[model samples]
Target: MEKPLAYRMRPRNLEEVVGQQHLVGPGKIINRMVAAKMLSSMILYGPPGTGKTSIASAIAGSTKYAFRMLNAATDTKKDLQIVAEEAKMSGTVILLLDEVHRLDKTKQDFLLPHLESGRIIMIGATTENPYITINPAIRSRTQIFEVKPLTEADILTAVDHALADKERGLGDYPVHMEENARLHLSRATNGDLRSALNGLELAVRSTPPEEDGTIHLTLEVIEECIQRKALTHDKDGDAHYDVISAFQKSIRGSDVDGALHYLGRLVEAGDLAIICRRLMVIGYEDIGLANPAAAARTVNAVLAAERLGLPEARIPLADCVVDLCLSPKSNSAYMALDAAIADIRAKGSGDVPDHLRDSHYKGAKDLGRGLEYQYPHNFDNAWVDQQYLPDKFKDAQYYQPKATGKYEVALGQQKNRIEQWRKESRQKPR
Candidate 1:
């Protein structure tokens, strides 16, 4: 059986590698390793189709090392042990373990001894964050190289190479792909080369053999083959900004259905975690003291989503989203801070007013830092008029908590005390 297009087109040497100019290019670490004929156990960390596995294969192929491959998704600890035992017999062995993050802690521990002793040069590939998912001890022993997604130009070069290679690709198929169609495929694949090539192959295969024997690919054909239309919430595209704007506005407008719809769109399009985090910020910025619980709830929801990890965590996120939307709305705190910052920026830095300066340190009293500062606790009502602000803005009121929800009751009590204090203080001889 013929190999898949992505596999067939895999780079066999460093020279053939398409992307990752940072690492695999000239004067790079990997290039040095290849030239020196010295290999180190390393972890390739990144999103899918970033040439993690291909890099490993190219290293094994170009060098004299005995190469072995395994998938963490399927392989057991026993399989690793077996490979390790076999690698011990071979002078140098290169073990490529794909999806290494999927291996549980106990399973991962099995390779620790072999990796440390240099019994095998391990190359691990993982899409997940290795810091959280992999065993710390194992991770510490492995050098980590991060691979990035291919750029549009890189993908285009790859497509051109694939279309021109007669033995390995569909050169005989007279298919002329439109620029729009190519761009659509690049966007839809989300920087995954395997996905893009698979998409191209599908588009080519589905096109009927014509009289001229030429297959012309249009945007509609590419969209149809891919099935999933590029969404308005693509993380790397302009749509991301527009969708998030809509989501925030919907929540601010108290349009629950609209908010939920936008939220659904973001969640389905794999931007839930980012959305949840933004909602947490919005809770504080938009809701503020009017509903202090809104910020706390949103923060808890983000934490829950992080700990629980998807589908299950979506419930908590949804709950926070609803609570934030329904909560008593106020941006008074946001406005207050904005005004404060504007003043600070315009004025540069102001002197610390003596009464508000640090007073606990030795000799502070001689400097008049706390010379006449009143102790509110010593007064009858446990309240006293004091100069807390700077001399330049002595009566400036930045944080005016809105009278809404729980803050309403608290603000009422605070206002009564302030009025009483003012009446007594004013009656006193100046």
Candidate 2:
């Protein structure tokens, strides 16, 4: 039987690998290693189909090493032992271990000395963050490199290469692929070249030749072969941050429709906890004091979402999302805290005013703490103009409220009155 398209299209050298220019481009560390033929044990990690296995294979092919393929999930200790014995005779062996996170204690124990002895050059492949999944002892033995997701252009390059190669690809067949179909494959696989190539192969192989012996690939055929396209999201990867950022920005921009669309994607991806946390942030960071009620409702929504969970949980989330998207937006509260924090960090903290320092403890009055602290409740309007900030920041004006909506507008009036009091206090003798 013929090999799968992904296997057939696998790059035989580092130059053929399309994406991850940071690692594979000229003068890059991995590129230099492959060029020098001085290979070492390393871990290749990232989401699937980003060419972890292909990189290992390419390295073995380049150096002409005795390459062995194994899966930590399926290959047993006996399998490793056989490979180890073969390595003893071969001088050195390059073992491409797939799903290396599944490396059991037995296999790990078996390979440790071999790796240390340089008898085995292990190229471990994992989709997990190896720092979290692999044992520290085993991880310490390998250099870790992250493989990034391929862009559409990268996948397109691979697809085009597969179509033109006569030796190992479908170059012999009359493959007529539509532009839309090519774009679909390029965009829909979520940076997994294996999925794109497989989908293309399936669309070509399964479809019968036309009257003129041409196998035409259209958007419909490609979509049918690939079925539903997943949202391009890795919960731990950049896509997660990108989508969450778009969601928050949509709400802050008061784009209800856009917010809902991102919410749907998150809901589909089952990133409920991120959604919960981001929604809480949107409440305070975006809506803020402009709509305190909306922020309160969002907190309630988050609690309900945690308790209820997706499908049903989307209801409370939908309500909160609509409210937040439509609510008056402000970042004054967020900006104020950041401004205060920047001063504290860069300028260094100043002495806490004696009037403001805690003085209720035993003998606290001896330091003159709380000596002349004014009681706000004793003054009219339940307010008093005092040096609340440390003496260094006593005149600092961090909260400049925007008179945007009814809530902030009311606060703005009160703020104006407070500024008058502050001016009078600044004029008084210290």
Candidate 3:
């Protein structure tokens, strides 16, 4: 039986690997390390079908090290112990642990001692963030190389190579791919080589063989094998980025319908709970003050999604999306902080103004910290005019409230109070 196109075309050497040139190209850090025989334990962090496993295979095959494979989702401590023992006997063992984040804390801890002592050089591949999923001890010891999605050019090149390799590819079959059909497959695959090849193979298989033993991939055949039309956001690939971009922009633009459309795409695609949490951050950072309820609603949506775990949770996500989009827009708070950061970066760190510094510490008063700092509560309205900013930034205004939502009304009242206080302070007898 012939192997599947994805497996048959698996890269055997670094030169054959597709995408992730930053890590695997000639003279790159990872390539240089492998060349010098100085590969350390490391984590390959990226989305699926970005050649993480293929890279590991290339390293194992081309290098002289003893290679061992294990899946963290299934492997136990006993399996690790056996590998460690083998490595101790042998000079070096490269343990490739796929889905390393799936290992529980205990299993992760089991490998730490061996890793520290250099009994095995570990290479872990994960789609999740290592900082949140893996053991800190193990992570601290390993170098993390981020793998990026393949470019359009990279995907096209892979397809061309697959079509040209008569030994292990569709080259023997006289299959002609239309330009539009090829572009559609590339875009739908979303930078995943495996997915692209699989889709192409399926399309070709669905077509009837010609008299010359050749199959032509027409638009009709490709569309028929596609099953479901590819969504704008695929949850696993570049579509995910495109959908999220549309969702955020819709909310920012106050287009409630557009926002809900993107929300539907995301929920249908089955993104993890963490992605919802990240969207909640956008609500807080982008729609704050002008729509104070937006942040709270977004947070509740994330929590609901986590609790219900899809299908049911999508309802709350939909509601939150609409609410955030309809809410008045404001990024004043975000702008204020960004401007403040820019100033800080340009001016460098400055000492806290004397009036704002803590005076409770020993010798703080003697050093003039907190000197002449008026107590706001001591005043009639619990407000006082005091120098809170550094001398250079005394007049800098960072918090400009916008005229929108309930916050705007409350802020207007507060502004009036502040003005009254300033007027009273000036009129008082010296």
Q: What overall lDDT goes with each candidate model?
A: 0.79, 0.86, 0.78
Model 2 misses residue 267 by how many Å? 8.5
Q: For model 2, what is the alpha-carbon lDDT of residue 366?
A: 93
Ten residues in sequence with the least summed lDDT for candidate 1: 228-237
Candidate with top lDDT is 2
> Which TM-score value belongs to model 3?
0.68
lDDT of 2 by residue, 1-430 (tens): 9889899987787887889889878999888987887677999999899998888877777778888999999989999999899999988899999999999999999999999998899999999999999999889999999999899889999999888888988898799987767776776676889988998889889999999999998777876787633345232235655788999999999999999999999887566767898999889998898989999999999999989977799999999999999998888978999999998998789999899889899888998989899999998778888778787887788887976668998898999988888788779998
Cα lDDT, model 3, residue 156:
85
Name the lDDT value of residue 121 in candidate 2.
95
CA error at residue 261 for candidate 1, angstroms: 8.4
Ranking by lDDT: 2, 1, 3
**Candidate 2 lDDT score at position 134:** 95
TM-score of each: 0.60, 0.65, 0.68
List residue ranges in candidate 2 displaced over 4 A. Answer: 229-250, 257-430
Model 3: how far residue 145 lies from native, Å: 4.5
Better of 1 and 3 by lDDT: 1
Better of 1 and 2 by lDDT: 2
Question: What is residue 320's positional error in candidate 2, in angstroms?
Answer: 6.9
